[model samples]
Target: MKRFIGFIKKEFYHIFRDKRSLFILFGMPIVQVMLFGFAITNEINNVDIAILDHSKDANTKQIIDKISASKYFSIKDFLDNERDIETAFKKGEIKAVLNFEKDFSKKLMTENQATVQILTDATDPNTANTISNYTSSILSSYQELLNKDISIPYQIGVQTRMFYNPELKSVFMFVPGVMTIILMLVSAMMTSISITREKELGTMEILLVSPLKPFQVIVGKVVPYILLSVINAIVIILLSIFVFSMPVEGNLFLLGAETILFIMNALSLGILISTVSASQQTAMMVSLMGLMLPVILLSGFIFPISSMPFPLQVISNIIPARWFIIILKGIMLKGVGLVYLWKETLILVGMTLFFIALSVKKYKIRLE
Candidate 1:
């Protein structure tokens, strides 16, 4: 009984002495819950939009006001010509554009019909589609108001054109998400476990004392995983294309490049995790519990971020997988190049750099 008690005490001391293990045991849950509970959302709000009102009459003004006043849209600018719509979308100033045909009131009253065009940047097909639906609902309400007092029937024809994804395939949405999960699991989880296994076997110290620099050692450990992740990404993409008939509308080279960036980001994250986990078991646990759940729930893979509570929406912005998925959907469905997805690309790049820097700093601290 005395020996068993002493053994338990020694184990507790060892766990407390290892800062990384203690953090994994205690700190990881707090971070995971905050990320999961706060970052997973499915609501959209304050979507930026541009309006082209050829009929600058009272009725047109009323409809525009309704759209602007709604929580779903913020009118950024009123354009003069149709040529500017593409420019605004490319500039990332607006997600949608409203085009009211000329003499809208005249057509509504005399001809008993009016036309309005809703053009959305379909790079993010789901968001673009949602914005269009909101806009249509607003216009429908206005139409009802205009006909409320009259026996004569009138209709507002909303011509909605979803650019990039005309059909809005559900497969278009999931391919990117699947790619993100696969890469995250393959790169981060695998690399962390591989590196930590060496520590568990007491081989890490021998490698640390060898001729290889810390960065070199980390790179060597991650490179094979990176290659495997790339292969996995390719396989997923091929399946999406051939089996699901998903379109690779954007530049294939760009898609490949972005996949590589995402894999690298995952690898850096794995290295950071490995630095904090002392054993293979700890690494696997952290990778699965601490990393996987957040990646799955917070990355906008299974749930729409806008639909979540506001706090969760804000937190979802920090997940690397969320940005990578956006980039993938843009390239795959919308055929958007770097011009459209540069922001997401830069975000992934920044996350990769941040993780690598953190891992380097933590490695230095441990060596000291």
Candidate 2:
């Protein structure tokens, strides 16, 4: 019984000494809880919306002031004409637009009715619908206020126009997000163990003794994953198209190119993780803990980035899945071409090169 107690004490000592174990036990849970708490919110804050006021009257100004005063939306643009609305949406910063019809005050005062169109970018249908509902609620409250003691009820008609996804189908958003997650899984999680597996099996030393260059070694290790990832990407796209009835409106070649770029970026990151990790389990833990959460939470997969806190929004720029999701959505839903997507494409390319260079540098150090 004494020896068993000693053994138990020894186990505790070992666990306490191992920082990684301690982190896994305590740190990870706290971090995950905090991340989920902050990032999983459905309520939007400081969402950028545009205003197109044709009347510019007292009622229009009051309604605009009420909307702008709210915490949910920030007025990003004051449009001159309807043509600029499409241009604003294409720029991607403007998520919603409030277009007040002509003679808003006149109509509301004389006819007891007025119309305001709520145009929303519905790439993520949930957000668009939520924005429309919130705006309508605000208008409804205003109508009630106007008719509080009056004999005739003042009516505010809200017309919602959902751009990119008129039907507000949930699948339209999920397909691109699922595609990003799957590709990241296939490319990063699998290859993250490649070098660690070699190190575990005692073949890493043999590879060091071999004449093959680090670049060749890394490339050789990741080639199969790259191919498999490409295949996986194609399958997801096909499934999205045939099964989910998702549209691929942009150039097929451009989409394929972007997909390949993202795959390479993920694979390179895996190689980097494998290079840094001492064991396959460590590699996987790092991959899962480090990559998965950021991909799911920070990448705008389920939540709108515009709604997240400023710091999380800034941090999300480093998440590869975010850019890839944007590219996929642009190509599939918006039918945008490289002209509009050049920035995201360049970012992925830069990330791929950065990871590969870092992994290669680490891999070369193994020889010395």
Candidate 3:
């Protein structure tokens, strides 16, 4: 019993002595708990939506006030024409649009019922579905409130129109996310590991001493992975279009250009990771474990960003995958082009340049 106790104590000491292992043991759990707790949530909040009030009366205003007052949605703009709903959705300004029938108050008072059209941008099926459900709930609550006062037989007929993904196919949502994850895993993780492998094998020093510039060496190492990532992206797109019958509404050339830009961004991130990690094992762990979760969770791939707490939503702004997913949804689902997606494209470009610059500085410091 004494020998066993001593052996256990020694193992504990060994574990405590290893900082990396200790961090992985204790710190990783805390980090993961915080991420899953804070970042991963199903509760929708502050969803950007628009309103088309054909009947701008007391009842319609009351419904609008109730919707705006709810934590689930934020009214962005009061649209004029029914025609503007599609334009607003394409511009990525709103997730859902609420349209009230003309003479809403009169019908509710005399006919005892009124119609409310809930049009959602269903590129993100989960969010769209949630928004529809929440809108219905709110309208139901409003009806209850009205009944409490006068026991009116008024009904709110909700006509939900899920645009882009009318059938709410899960494949429509997953393909873009799968492409983002695969490209990230392949381009960033593989490039980092490949670069660190050269360093681990002592070949990096030889490359440094060679006539090839460090940037040239880094570019040469990453070019293969870039090509692979591009090929993988093309395959994912083809599969989405052919297998899933997913529509590509936007310009194909623009999508290809954006894919190349994102690949370059991910490659820069990999190069930065390689500069920080001394060995291939470290690079692999950092890329696979560190980068993977954020790409999956915080990027709004699985969880709706609006549904997450404010802090997580703010943090998600830094994730490259988040922007890419938005771009993908915009182009693939909304048929939006550069005019609608230029902001996200510029963000990716900025991030790529920042990573490349940081990596270059780190590489120069290592040489010194």
Candidate 4:
């Protein structure tokens, strides 16, 4: 019994001594709990919306006040004309716009009825549906309050029009997100393991002693993976178009160019991973486990970033997938060109360059 107890004590000491093991034991659970608890909510919080109140009546003012008071929404801006709604949506500033019909109070007094139009961007159908439902509930409550003191029942009709995706198809949202995830994980995983495999086989030394420069070595290692990842992207886009019957509303040539840039970004990230890791297993684990959650959650793939906490929203900005998904939706659904998407495109370009330069620096450090 004493011998067995000593052995157990020694194993515990060994586990406590290893930093990686300690992180796996304690850090992983805390991170997973925090992320899952915070990032997985279905309810919308502080969703940005616009107001276009043509009525400017007492009733319309009261409804606007009620909506602004709700925790689920934030009034981003007030549109002065009908033409500004599209501009708001294309700029990605607001999710929905509330248009109060003219003579709202007059209609309510004479006819006991009025209409409000809810124009929502349905690129993300779940959020659009949620916003519409929540807005309608608030309107219903106001209607009930008005009826409580009067003999006549009042009705506020809500007419919802989903923009970008009129049908609110789930596939339209998923395709861009899935394509980003697959290209990112696959490219990173494959390239990450490649150099690590070489290191484990003892061929990394031979390549290091060869005439190739550090950047050249890194580029040569990643070029093939970039090509493969691009091919994978092409296949996915084709499937999204043909199999899912998804519409490509923007320029196909531009889409192709952006896809290549994203693939290169993913590949460079993989090279960075392999350069830092000592083994294939380590590289593989870092590529898959370290990246999976952030890509899915923080990239605005499943949930709205604006709905998350302010910190998470800020952290999401650094994620390449977030920018790429924006580009995809802009081109595929909104039909916006580079003129409008320049910021997101520039972001991807900067990230790709940063990853490649950092990987080269890490590679040169290793050569020392």
Q: What is the TM-score of each candidate against the true structure?
A: 0.58, 0.60, 0.60, 0.60
Per-residue alpha-carbon lDDT of candidate 2 for residues 1-368, written as tens digits (9 for 90 to 100) = 45344434544454457576445434443343334334544557789999999999999999999999988899998999999999999999989999999999999889978999999999989789999988998998887788779775576656879989886666677778777876786578777775687788887788677765677667776766676677677767776688667899999999999999999999999999988888989999999899988998999989899999999999999999999999999999999999999999999999999999899888744633
lDDT of each: 0.78, 0.82, 0.81, 0.82
In model 1, state the lDDT of residue 77: 96
lDDT of 4 by residue, 49-159 (tens): 999999899999999999999988999999998999999999999999999999999999999789999999999998899999999989989988998876754856568
Candidate 3 has its poorest 10 consecutive residues by lDDT at: 29-38
Instruction: Give the per-residue lDDT digits (tens) of candidate 3, residues 1-368.
Output: 45344434544454457576445433443344334434544557799999999999999999999999998899999999988999999999899999999999999999999999999999989889999998998998898889886654676656878999896666667767767876777778767876787788887777676665566666666665566567667766876787668899999999999989998998899999999999889998999987789999999988999999999999999999999999999999999999999999999999999999898878742443
**lDDT of candidate model 1 versus the reference:** 0.78
**Model 1 ranges off by over 4 Å:** 1-152, 160-163, 364-368
Clashes by residue pair, model 1: 38-312, 39-312, 41-304, 41-305, 41-308, 42-306, 42-307, 42-308, 43-306, 43-307
Higher-TM-score candidate of 2 and 3:
2
| Clashing pairs in model 3, backbone N/Cα/C closer than 3 A | none
- What is the descending TM-score order? 2, 4, 3, 1
Candidate 4 steric clashes: 0
